[model samples]
Target: MSKGRGKMKKDTNIRIGTRGSALALWQANYISKSLSKLGVKSEIIIIKTLGDKLTRGVLSQNRNRGKSFFVKEIEDALLNYEIDIAVHSLKDVPPDMPDGLILAAVAKREDPSDAYISRKGNFLDHEKRKSIIGTSSPRRIAQLKHFYPEFSFMTLRGNVETRIRKMHELKLDGIVLAYAGVKRLGRKEEITKKIPISVILPAAGQGAIAVECRKKDRKVISILKELNDRRTSIAVEVERRVLTKLEGGCQVPVGVLARWRQDTLLVSAVIASLDGKEYLKEKSVMNQNNWKKKCDDLAELLLNRGGRAILKSIRK
Candidate 1:
């Protein structure tokens, strides 16, 4: 067969499943555009998940039920063959892959720093005792307590716009959100400050878009290879592996970020008590070639340095 004919034969229309949020649509449209450049046709299908439906109050009541909260319904659609692809905010995906699903690609990441948005300028530095900051992420809450325990935190939840609106309606002093989401949604101007990674490490795969497909779908996997970013894939993989070893998730107060610098991989990880009283942090730098083993070693180091006890107490 001619190469042109072969290419035509392989050009199957892909069905992409994603959440209905603005950020999720941005990611889905991004993949769709990237595929269009490669001469592939695709459709974006919105699927709502439990994460979207549950309020913060319900979530607090069911702390143990959110690792795959955002991606579960989308994955179900993919597994049932209703969709050929599933795009997700990599941070929302659990470290453990479902039996039949595989992470086919990791798109190039956006800025991984969390953004601090306040109507009042530069709130993190100012001496504002008892200010009500808005966030529900255990990781963010723990770090904020550890660093700026003077401020009070309220559980804030919704899509980006909703959260931002709530910050006004609830009279919140400020809110911390992923800068990637804010930039993607064209709300960069709303960010009063970009939180430094040194102050609060991002969750594993925080800024990257993850593509998932059935394990046996070789054609979808091949198509997705064009979307994969190597450095990002390695960095998220290393971070996720560390989180998996630690058995950390949305319910746990753990933060991890991995980056590639030339041929080296640098990972900074932290595990803290829910109240932020006790904490364990480790920064590991290792050769990128042996990243798997190095990531395991890094997790072990954190666990040995009081991480295990912190996790045990939190679970209990």
Candidate 2:
């Protein structure tokens, strides 16, 4: 086919499934626009998951038996042929997935680092240091225990907006969040400080968007070949493989964030006990091209060294 004809042919119709939330919609639209640039026509279908239905709980508080907490409902639609593909915040997706579902693409990531939002100028106000900081993740809780043990934290469960509003209502000093989410929601002004990823190793796949499709959907995969971001995939995959190997669940505290600088990958890992008194933090720099293997090896080493001890301590 001629280049023009190929462009026209690439204008395949696609249905993108996503959660009916502001941040999800933003990510979906961003993908849709990027697809349009390559002549693909797309629409978004909103699907609700169990996590979305819950109003007052954290995922870690719930039990897991291999079912995905955030992506299962949407993946069901993909398998049923109700939707061609599903887009998600990678952090929300569990490390493991259901049968017949495959993570097809990961878009270029934004800042994977967390942020602190304080209404009173500086994100973490020493004056309000004794006040509460809102969050629902045990990983965050563990880190807080290790670093900012004095600050009080409560389960701030709900959508992004709801959590932010709750922080205002409680008149808490500040709330912690993923920097990427706030930027996607167009709430840059709400940011009080950009937390360093160096210290707060982010959740796996935190800043990227995930596209999942039925493993058999070759057409959808063919079309979405245009949407894959290789660098983002490499970085997220490296971290995710570690999670998979170590049996990381939302309930435990394990965080890893790896950054690519030219030819080198700087990886940082944090393993913390449930009580956060004892912690194992480590960092290593390796050739970026071999990051995937480096990360997997690091996860293995961590488990053998002190990660196993930390996990056992936390589960008890």
Which candidate ranks first by TM-score, i.e. highest? 1
Best by lDDT: 1
| Candidate 2 lDDT by residue in tens digits, 1-316 | 2212222124456888999889989999998898889777888999998777765664655534222766778887776777778999997788777777888889999999888887576645353547677887777777877777777887787667988898889886777889999988989788887877655778888999998887776777876777898778877877787777767765668888767887566777788875577777777676656666777788878888888878876555
Worst 10 residues of 2 by lDDT: 1-10
| Full-model lDDT for every candidate | 0.87, 0.77
Q: Whole-model lDDT for model 1 versus the true structure? A: 0.87
What TM-score should be assigned to candidate 2?
A: 0.90
Backbone clashes in model 1, listed as residue pairs: none
TM-score of model 1 (CA atoms): 0.95
Candidate 1, residue 204: the lDDT equals 88
Predicted candidate 1 versus true structure: per-residue lDDT over 33-137, tens digit per residue: 999998889989999999888865876665566767888899888777878899999999998878989999999999888889985775698838878899988
Question: How high is each candidate's TM-score?
Answer: 0.95, 0.90
